[model samples]
Target: MRDPAANNGRELARSPREPPSVNCRLEGDPTPMQVAKRYRDATPESDRLPAKKARLLSTNTQQLGTENETQTKKTTLQQPEPRRSKRSYASFLDDFADEALVHRRPELLCTFVSEWLESVESDREKHCRSDSHLHPSDEQPVARLRTRSAPVMVKARDIGGFTVPPTPSSTGPPSFRADLDDDRSRSSSSSTANVRNPRYRQNNLRFNCIHVRHATSPLPVTLSGHVDSLRAQRSSPGLSSDDLNQAMYRIDVLAEGCDEEQVVKLLDDTVFPDPEGDDTFGPATGLMSNSSTLMAQHLVPADGASPYRVTQPKPDRLYGYSERTVGGAFTQSQLLAQTMLHDRNPDYTTATSRGLRFPFLAIQFKAVGGTRGDLWVAANQCAAASSACLNAVHQLNISLQACQSTRRVDNLSYCIAVDNKLAELYISWREDSSNYYLQQVDTFVLSRPVEFQSFRTQVRNILDWGKDARLTQIGDALDVILEENRKNAAQAAKSRTSPPDDPAASAKRQKPSSRRNSKGSQSSQTQICATNPTLPEAEAG
Candidate 1:
C-alpha cells in the first residue's frame, strides 16, 4: 500500500546505527519492544552497539530494572507505618532538669553559707570544750615533723605521745608480800560467802562488771578530750619483729611509680596475706576479719557542695566490723535506730549483704607518685567514714541514756592513708553529741626500714584492738541498752497491774517519764556533721 519512493525516504531519515523511537499509548504500560527502544534512545550514541551485542544489553537492563521495581513495591505494601505514642511525664521534666533554684532564679548564696557556718559554730559550742579545759599535765605534745626535707618516720610511742611507766617492781618491800598474803586470805574467805559460777573470759580480757569510772558530774565533751586521753595512755604491743621484717621485705619488692591498683593489691597482700591453697590460716574462725574496696552507696555524702554528682566513699580496705564480728549484737538495734533514733539510717549501716559493716579501721590508697594533697584528700574520706562509725555509737549512747542507764559510749576510729612513699595514720572520734574531730597520728615512709616497721606494728595493733577491745566495747553497750529496755518494760507492766488505790502506782501513772515524752525531740539533737575537721596543711615540697 506504500509507495516505493516514500519507503526509501524514511530509511534515509534514520541513521543505520541509531535504534528506532518508541511509540505507545500514554494511558497504560508499554510493551517490551517499546521499553527497549526508550532505554536505547536515552543512552548516549557512543554507548550504542551494533548487531547481537546491542540487543543482549537492552534485554538484561530491562529484566534487572523490572525485578528491582517489583521488589520495592512489594516491600512498601507489606510494611505498615509506625504509630505515634504520647510522651511520658519524665520526658516533659527534661526541659528543667538542670535548674536548681525555683524558676531558675538566683538568691543570696552568701547568706545561705553564713547561716550554715553559724549553725556549725553553735553546735561546736554546745559540746566542744575550750582549750582551758585541759590541765597542764593533760596537755598533748606538739605535732610531729612532716617536713619535705626528710621523709616522716615515727613509732607508737611518738604517735601516742605517752611514755609507758616502768613496770611496777614485782619485788617490793618485805611488807608488800605480807600485805598480799593477808589480802589473799581475806579474798578466799569472801569467796566462800557467795558461791557463783565463774564467767568464761575470752583471751583473759576483763569483760565482767568492771567499769571505767567517770567524774560525778561528768558531761559529754568534745572528741578532742577522748583523743587526748587515748594519747596519754600506753599502747599495746602489735606486730612482732619477724612480722615487721617480712612486711618490709614485701614493701621493698614494690616498684616505684606503681599505679593505684597495684599499690592496693600489694598492701592487701602484705598486710592480710591469703593462705596458700586450702590449708587455712588456722581453724575456721567464722568471724570476718577484713573486707575491701566495696562501694558505700547507702551512706550520705560528706561533700554536699559538689558541683557534679555526689561521690560515695569506697575505702581501699576496712577492718574489724562485720555481722559475724559483732555477733549480730547490733543487728536489731541498728534496725530500730533506723526508724527511732536517726532521720535516716546511720552512715555506718552499709545495707549490703557482705559489705563492710560499721568499720572501725578504714584505709585509702593513692599511686606511688601521689602528692601530699592527694593524701589529704584520702584523709578527708577517712575522716568522714570514721565519723560515721563514731556517730553510730553516739546514737546508741543516746538510746541508753534514755533508759536511765549510767553507761556512756566514748570510742575512737582509725584511718590510714597509704601511697607510694608515705603511710599516714589518722584518728577520728565523736567530740560530743553534735561535734566530731580528726587528727593525724603519725606518718611513715614506705621505703625506709625503721619507719615502715613502726607503721606495720601500729597498724597491726589497731587491727587487733578493733577485733578484741573495740568489739567488746560495742557489744557491751548494745547488751546494756537491751537489758535496760527489758527492765523498763517489766516495770511498766508491773505498774499497770498494781492496785488503782496504790500511791506509788498512782504517782507513776500521773507522771510519765520525760524521756518517753521527749522521744520525738531526740531527732533534732541527733543531727551531726559527717565532714572532716579542717587540718593545717603542711607546705608541699
Candidate 2:
C-alpha cells in the first residue's frame, strides 16, 4: 500500500533504485517532490541528489533544517538597531564640573580681562577706520533764566567788577515800577527841594554801596546801584544813539542782575553757541568724566590702577550746562557723575586742564523699579549709554592714530540695571563704520529670590560667569538639550500617527474559524441546537 504522506504529496523522498531524477515541471499545486526535483536540477553534478532512498531522505531532512536556520538568521539581521540614550543637563554639568569651579575663582578675573584685551587688540584692524570725521555733535544749551515781575538788582561787587555809580537818580534809566506814585512824587519833590536848599550839594552827597562776592571769582567788589542805572550814568554826553547802544552791549552785566523781560528778549534774539571744534569748549569732556568715575567706582578697587580711565580736560568740574541743569537735563546716574566724581564747584565751567586717559571703560548704571515705565526708561538709558561709548571709543581710536601712539585703544562699555528683585548686565562695543554705532555683545539676566545675601551672590556669580568662558559653554549645552527634546517630541508624534503592524492580528482576521463568534451569533446557534436536538440524527438516517 502507498504511504498516506506520499499520496498527499507531502514526502519529498522516493526509492533511489526507481529514479535518481523526476520531472521538474509543476502541475496545479506544486508538491514537495516537484520542488525537490527543481532543487536537484539547479545543483552541480558533484552536489546531485543521493541515489539510495534512506540517504535521500537523510539529505532532504538536513537541507530543510539548514534552510530554516538561514531564514531565522536573515530575520534577526533585518531587525532595527537600538538608539543611543539622550544626554541630560545634569550629566553635562558633571562633565565640566572642574572647569566651572575654575571659572568661579576670583583670581581668574585678571586672566580673563587680559585675554579679552588681547582679543580686542587682535581685532583692532577690522574696526579701525582711516576716516577722521568726527561724530555729528548735538549741543543743547540749558535755559537758565527765571521769570519775575520786579527787576532784581545784583550789586557789581558780587560779580567781582567795579562800575561807575548812578548820577543820584536825576540821570538814571526809567524806573522798573512805572505804576508807583511814591517814586514819581519823590523825584519831583527832591528836585524842587534840592534847588531851594543851597546847603544840599550834589558833589558832597554820600552814596550807599553794597559789597558782594562773585559766583565764579573769589574777589569782592562794591556797587553803587542797579547795573542798568550805572550803564545809563556811564554813557557819554555827546554819544549818538547807535554809539550808546554799542556801549550798552559792551557793558558786562551780571546774569543775576538781568531783568526777566531783558532775559527773555536776549534769549529770543541770541543765536545758539557754535559747535566747539576742539573738545576743550564743549560739555562732552565733563559728561565723559562723570561716566568714567561711575564705572571706576563699581568695577575697580579705589586704589588699584584700572586699565581704563575716564578723562576730561577738566575732571575737577562738570560742564557748565551739566551743573546748571543737573537733575532736569540728565538722570540720577548722570547727576551722580557730575557731583560725586568731582568737587562741588558752583562754577560749572571750572575743570581740570588735563586731557582724558586712553583705553578707558565706560559704565552707566540705571535704577529700575518693577513698573513697566521704569523698565522702558532703563532700556532707553542703556541705549543712550551704548551710543555714547561707541562715539567715545571711535574718537579715542582716531586721536591715538593721530598721535602715532603704538598702543591700540579699544572702547569697552557696560550698562547695568539695578533692581531689588532683578539685575541685568549688558556689554557693548563700537562697530567699524563711517557713522558711529555700538553693537551689544550680550545681556545676562540674574534672577533669584529677593533675599539680599542670595541676590548679591547671584549677581556676583553672573558677573564672574560673564567674564569667564563657562557662560558660552552653558549656553551651547542648553541649546543641545533643547534640540534633543524637540527631536524626541517629533518622533513620539510620528509613532502616535501610524499604527504598528501585527502579523498575528492579520492572520486571525483572514482565518474566520480561528476567531471566536460574536455574542449574538453564539446565542442564536445555542437556541437552534436546543430547538432541534435530533436534526443531526435524522439527517444521518
Task: Report lDDT per candidate.
Answer: 0.52, 0.34
- Counting clashing residue pairs in each candidate, in order, gives 3, 3
Model 1, span 1-541: residue lDDT tens: 3454564456347433222222222334442333444555688877655844666688899999999998988877343457653222222233322222221223322333344455445544433234334322236543455766985644334344553455545778879888998989865653332111122111011121111122132434654454344333225444577766776666666544457776777666555433122122211211243444544544422323321222244566665444432444246664343334344554445423464455677788877553322675676566545655665566667777786778775566778888867898777655435445556756788878777656766665565555556656666766776666667789899888983587987778867776666774554434322132242223110
Deviation in angstroms for 297 in model 1? Answer: 6.2
Candidate 1, residue 258: the lDDT equals 55
Predicted candidate 1, C-alpha RMSD: 39.6
Question: For model 2, how does the per-residue alpha-carbon lDDT over 395-488 read when each residue is reduced to its tens digit?
Answer: 4344334434444434444444433223343444443433222223223332212222232333333223222332233223323334444566
Per-candidate TM-scores read 0.42, 0.20
Best by lDDT: 1
Model 2 error, position 482 (Å) = 54
lDDT for predicted candidate 1 compared with the true structure: 0.52
Off by over 4 Å in 2: 1-373, 403-407, 433-541
